[model samples]
Target: MKYQKVLIVLLTICFTGWVSLSCHTNESGGGELNDGLIGYWKLDGDGIDYSGNNLHAELIRSRKRPDSGSTNDTEHNDAWHQVSASSNLKMDDDFSISVWIDALSPDRDVSGDIISQYDVGRRKGFHLSLTTNPSPTGVGNSRRLSFGMDNNIASEWMDCGRPGQALLAFGLAEYNGDLYASTCEPEAGGAGHVYRYDSENNTWKDCGAPDRSNTVFALTEYKGALYAATGKYRVAGSSLPESENTQIGGRIFRYEGAENWVECGQLPGVEAIMGLVVYQGELYASSLYSPGLFKYEADNTWTRCSTPDGKRIQSFGVYDGHLFATSYDLGHVYRFDGTEWVDCDQVGQNNTQTYGFSVYQGELYVSSWPSGKVYAYEDIKQWRDVGRLGEELEVMGLIVYNGQLLGGTLPMAEAYRYQGDTTWQRMDQLDTTENVKYRRAWTMTEHAGRVYCSTLPSGHIYAYKAGETVAWRKSFPEGWHHVVVSKSANKLSLYVGGELVDQKSIPTSDSYHLSSGSPFNIGFGQHDVFQGRIKELRMYNRVLTKHQIDVLGSPD
Candidate 1:
């Protein structure tokens, strides 16, 4: 009986040791390397955390699809998995988040979050997403992967100097890592000129006028080259005296180099090229005064697409594999699926026109005229009025900057950042021109780590370096891609499929403590809900070495 008891004790000890070993081993039959792993979720059939950390996530408003490899399955924007905030999940200075995702093509012109734990109210924490629009410096492209973080501090606004004797910096675009602005210079011998911003010298280098028109209204990048659109902007629209320059400008031009432009022909029966956008590998342009929508075919060639109800369209955006346009007529929003235009109905009963569109936190928001109100898109023909921007009469430029939705208003020339439901906090009065009948904080773009806005009347470019974001600036490509984001010391690094794609340094003084109190999200955060399938999400409390990340990202 004594010998039998001793044998039982030995067996029990061996059994306990085997159980401990099994807990450390991953489901893929790997061990030892996942030492700092605090959470590992194999979202195969559920949100169970297999890291033995009990950090299981909860699915909220999520629906399972057959994984058809396209966005045609169903709307996944409302779905996400949430893990409760815990001590282990609160990252310090060094940490990493790695995941495998099969991102679906966006159904709207908006960025979608992959993984995040952010507090939009406080503007703190970190997020990884895919951008559907260009950044201010024009360094990154649409559909590029981006990672950003907010340190809970207000950024100082800097005046980036005026672009010539221009009344307005009409449009902004980025090309070849350089920032360019198109101006409406009504001064004598000051026809619309495109100026390149020299960041090192903090001055605008005149790239000469693309046309004799009074305004170079719009700018876009297409097929590795910069394109500019011209307009004979009616100053009367701003309650200002009409300019003597009567040069017609319904033409488009391609930038050749320093002080040179190549004519790309003119739009038939159109007076101004109001907006330009690239949708599904093709360039599309809108007419300012006419109900015309044309697609670029070749140099000096364009094909006219059917306009929505024969109504004029203005600002262009892309979402959900379709093109979206704000109307200069009827104030309605329209969606074009590369074939027919679907009327999205008017924004508000009192508003006369819609100016710009931005996607924030999985919903589309638009700025309106007359009412100066911003509306969030809910469903077909449905919009919820978020709020009005102070006492302004018109709201123009709308963009998602540093995890917040911001709008530029006319008359006051003020910029307001969204602060949740029906609440907006004024950031600043960008255009401080005294006694002007109408002043406008007109257009905006993101570049480097700053948000830049142009002002009418002042014609000055103002920039605020807010949160830091590093982007890949290229399409993320189809199929499952392994993505890893890591923060070590004062630098953020992004790795895709085991290769370092981009890296940027963060200020050491900035707060890197990522304990935002927000729940750790798997498919949702600051941007829209992810429209894709995610699996094998792992979070570590320490920076992962390149070799470790490579081994994990390698195809099985």
Candidate 2:
């Protein structure tokens, strides 16, 4: 369908169902589609509006579409159809624009513009386009839906945790009487596999693949069925282009009785969905594609809803009786206050990447990247810094268990129990061994009276029995580490060479005024004895910056 001067279908009028929109450019106010849709371009060969209105699309084909002369013949990166500034294209207080097109090349670096008159810097006009998407597994040619208005500043077409960085487990949920999670181990080509926790056996059993996809990112239960959102279409055992590790699309699947699963639908404009939630008796899903909120109506039936103030809607959770979601790029939170989505403000810090959302103690909390800190939601105006989980960058998965919230961290690939928003306790040594050593704890859930978790790299699930949490804190192996521990009436600081690594409050009155003994029997006197070899231990009368600590702790 190249350039035939064809009669293009411009969706103008509105309808009862958003999926079933009314768009006949024949005349304004003639059909339900009413936001003054002025111009229409057929791209058959011209930018003439078919609405009987004289407004025509301008010549701004940054990349022109070559005339194939027949639909069978295809054209690649021909050009873009566009219209200059027009009041008709401008958006109002509330509006929606829809389009129908066959995106040419998903491999194109610059996203293919579907429709828009947006001025990004001015942040005024609206834009809809087919943006390139690389699956979590590997980069492959793929295009997903993306849309945003100039007013919506954070409107980027794609988000995978962080820009250009691989994502951890994208989805997690509870089903039946057991907990289930999907693994996104792109490095091992173990994508799109599901695992079910068997508490009785204290292990995970592979649930197998839902379809031929890289990974499953979102899982939910609705109306007596287990639904899994899966995508990232890279061929197994093949290396994507070193330059572009683009992930493909994903689909929605339903557990068809016992172990069987069937396809129910796919995320609109996007191949995969980040998070899903049951709100007001309706199932809503968030996507980096169309980059907005969508409500599921039926199989293959979803309606687009509100747009967020950020680029990508990474995940969603219901908090304080309201549906709250996090936008990844801007690290901001938005809430559904029954009527529409309202900006609940953003997390303040260098970590602009917000990953998961969960509510604990009736308060809302979100996990972030790079900084690896969690923040508590008080209102749209303020967020309390809940502290860091460790030195991990991506605090990928977060869930509530045992009357407390648990978060999963990256690089270390471990889980931590949140304590009073001030301290965090290690969950356990679930990931023990080499090979799969550096994975992240992707998801944590409770099943059969136990906490079960899943991790990346290995893409395996493990169960945690009711017992004392382990404090297997290890020290820098033979190297110089600047470990700094600050002291209070009840606590003392622990520093390696110079860095403020960790701090714990141990009772007993004794300050380390000397560089001699095992520092009060490794402190806590009765807990245990030091098992590893120790070298230079220094007591500093002052705190040191990371750089100074590094220099002091350096082995060289």
Candidate 3:
């Protein structure tokens, strides 16, 4: 009851041997749960993995022990990660990643050795970590970057101290002379310093505003830009401040150039902005304490994208031509197809994990939290349990490149790549992992016989050419949300939204340039199966001019 600001209840009713998704549809007025369950025949269908009583019993047991502090409760927390076995989780020119999480610990004391200790003396709940690779210590240590609640106030903890360090929030990024400071623990300096590793020089440098008191709760890179939201005030290297004023406010900011972290936008009505993403050429922000999603247009404006039925969004990802967001309340996955949002949790038989999501090889892949199992779904309303991976590894970001599905893990900066069926390869062997710790490949792009993966928190980019062991890396001027590589007769063209951002040309033989596939396999490479949606797909065997590319953006 401490933080139950919103309650989302989903009920199941059985009437006349029929399983209804609603207990009292008229009373709730939330709409029908399942319209296809009206009539029931004998249990017979294709691609339906019915575990009979076993799955049913597991679900029942989970519901009965909802208050248990076991990992099972957290395993199913809808904060899981995803990986692909084939192609990358491709998004339409626009997409967003949304996630909801129930914070487990508000205090930094986790009953373990103090590898890192820089607490801002606030309530730091749900710490999210980020680090640089090759590690500053040169032994591949996890330079974790975690975001948590400090003193009932949302703050961030940088693991620059150790594998699991907790640094307190000193201040916010402001343009004026005075830096934003916490009301409590005024002795600590505002504008906390974050270390961004310069891979070329192999050294850590202080980035972000120095000597400010703005607390950035959530950070994301959208459309070649870095965005952060301010929430909950607390002093660095301390505990929860006793003032209610520092514990109850929120704001949003975006980094301009390299040092000036200015306020770009704000979540007006929402209580706390948890996540931000760029979908369908527009920016989307998710609020953990609210049921709706907001979008930012090209003209720099925000609007509510859609309102869910009181479900808290845990995480969001864009695949194929639709937008997918996970719900923490009842393991529901919602898909936005540029229109109304459709509840497709039934895709996983109501037992699906709502945390991790990815789109790979034309299929929507979901990795369940706590449970640590992965499932692939042709449809989000119906999921197919594939198999299990590592135990207790909370899978987060999933990407596919060069015929392999890659996944990012927490606590451990090591990432795994799925090789074919039942084969998992360590991604750290590649040279790219040498410079990134806790690198979540949120954005993956392929162009000119090479795959590009960008890591979060560090904002570094790495490109792996075909048959190459080491990745050619670079730093972005701004964090990029999504990357698109368009090919016109063997020539590579890149575009964001409808504008061309990056491009290159590759020489091709006659066999490579003249090949054509139906439906034009837009999301995942060239595949026959249509697992995801195709918004606007066009393939040309012959080279098209710049005018033609513009026409593709607007068909006549």
Candidate 4:
């Protein structure tokens, strides 16, 4: 067997087997196989010659394709497989799944025998089309990994018309009542993509590719909004294929608590995206072409920094600094270089397919989308394959926060967060403002240890005192620009474009006056007094110096 040695080692993985039999897995499916191989046998034991078609099996992993970002390989891709009822793809309460697969060309014909539950003549259910190669759109080549619900199900399969070649297929899985899928490709020109099947309507909506010219590079759903990244340009119009695109660079889009996708802003200077991950604090996107990664500071503006040379960025997470990420196509882990991107000697490469990347317990983790294994590169060379998941688990956005590893699906509106233990939690329906009904937080900032989340589309700013919602908000001038606080003094001032508008003195001495609770928002702190986007805000404990106040109150 081509992978005989590796296959034996994989079959021995206890964690992989546990995932297959465990019922706790989240809806975004993918897991390893069990020892008995009764249920949905997760793709494990790499060398096993399942080519004989004796047992139904599935493989799940992340996707990690090349792009303009990192020269190194982060192995951030995921791959998985779905089998027939005989494959026993049922789950109980708690489980975790992961996998990796190098996709073949989309032109290759894959009969149900290679991926589905049926034999050559068995018309059991769905057909598996790995990659859509020689595609209509010349820009991005795509992969369609779908399954029909048995002959009775009428959903048509969007066949990619390719198979057996080393394309990238990460993984997919079903846990509890949720379902998850992923894919990986170059961040440039949106080569890789993903989609979601609305079981309620029996429809497959275009989750990633909004247009034909741009492919989906990264995707995630947070707080009810769906976030996706494309190769530096804004994508418009459906049905248009990426193959016709001429723009370079990348951009991120948001589907705010609604079905329609809205444009957020352009990704500063990023031309291509290798990986995207949310760690510690904010959203992070890496450029496959550029060594630098962009961090969402508040809204459109990003904190841009470059990675070490000889290595490109694949994925990112927050380890020690505010961020951490991996390099792909080249195998390495790149950490925040304080001022720029530097290689984290602490996190080196250990796996062959380093496609997907994340951070957990102050440790940097990388997943091999092709191999269907996850490796942790902490302080040494102890690389081990934790387990497997559904085939083609293309991990798009990997986040670790509040003691959990949150993974995102590319080209799809699915999100999953690991619940510390072995169980995975599905957060399919995020809080994208629908629950709020009226309030839509556009940006947030911290001042004097206090957090403030600004609500846009309504021009309201809400303040929190000691994490508790407060009743202070200040309205901005007619044209608010830099609504910032002075450095030396506690003065909140506003500057419209290149002119100072107003300067309000925050009573630092009189607790009673401060207790009265002024406006919590910068623009419109009082009533209909201010408008426009606030450029900046800062706060200090004491009164500011004349120079500091002037600086804060100075026009651009």
**Per-residue lDDT tens digits of candidate 4, residues 1-556?**
7699788888878667777546334211222122222222223332122323343423333222111132211111122232324222321111111112232211111101112222111212222112111100010111222211122111121222111110222222121112222232323444434444344553333444433323355554333344666662222211122233455536666644223556655766666564555443356676766566677775667777555674666654333233445555445555563456555442223333244444343234555433433455533334444343323233333432211244433222234434433344454421123322221221122222122222211222222222101111121112222222221224333333323434444345411112111112111110011101122222223333343433434543
* Candidate order by decreasing lDDT: 1, 2, 3, 4
TM-score of 1: 0.86
In what order do the candidates fall by TM-score, top score first? 1, 2, 3, 4
RMSD of each: 7.6, 29.3, 23.3, 29.0
The model with the greatest TM-score is 1
The global Cα lDDT (0 to 1) of model 4 is 0.33
What's the lDDT of the predicted structure labeled candidate 2?
A: 0.47
lDDT of 3: 0.35
Tens digits of per-residue lDDT for model 3, 1-556: 6334333222222242244324344212223211111111111211111212111101112222122234331222211111111112222122111111122221111111000111111211111111111100010111111111111221121121110111222111111111111111122333323334332453334455422433344444444455555444333212223222333323456666555666655556665454554455566667656675777653335776665666766466554445667765666678776667888764344343455554443355665544444567555356666644444344444544333455554323335656544445555411223343332333233322233333333334344433211111222121211222334443444443345544444334312211111111111121112111112222222333444444333422
> Cα lDDT of all candidates, in order?
0.79, 0.47, 0.35, 0.33
TM-score of each: 0.86, 0.49, 0.44, 0.34
Span of ten consecutive residues with least summed lDDT in model 2: 521-530
Which 10 consecutive positions of candidate 1 have the poorest summed lDDT? 65-74
lDDT of 1 by residue, 1-556 (tens): 9999999999999999998767635423565457788899988867899988899998876232221134421234556788998876877778888889887654334447788888877788888887555321121235557788876766767899999888888787656556789988875555989998888899999999988989888888777688888988888888877877888898889999999999987999988888887877788888988899889899899999999888998987765456778887878999888898888899999888998877677666788989999998766688899999888889888777667777789898898888988888888898888877999998787666567889989899998866677766455665789999988888988899988878988777777786888898887766667777788889888888887787678786
Q: How many backbone clashes does candidate 3 have?
A: 69
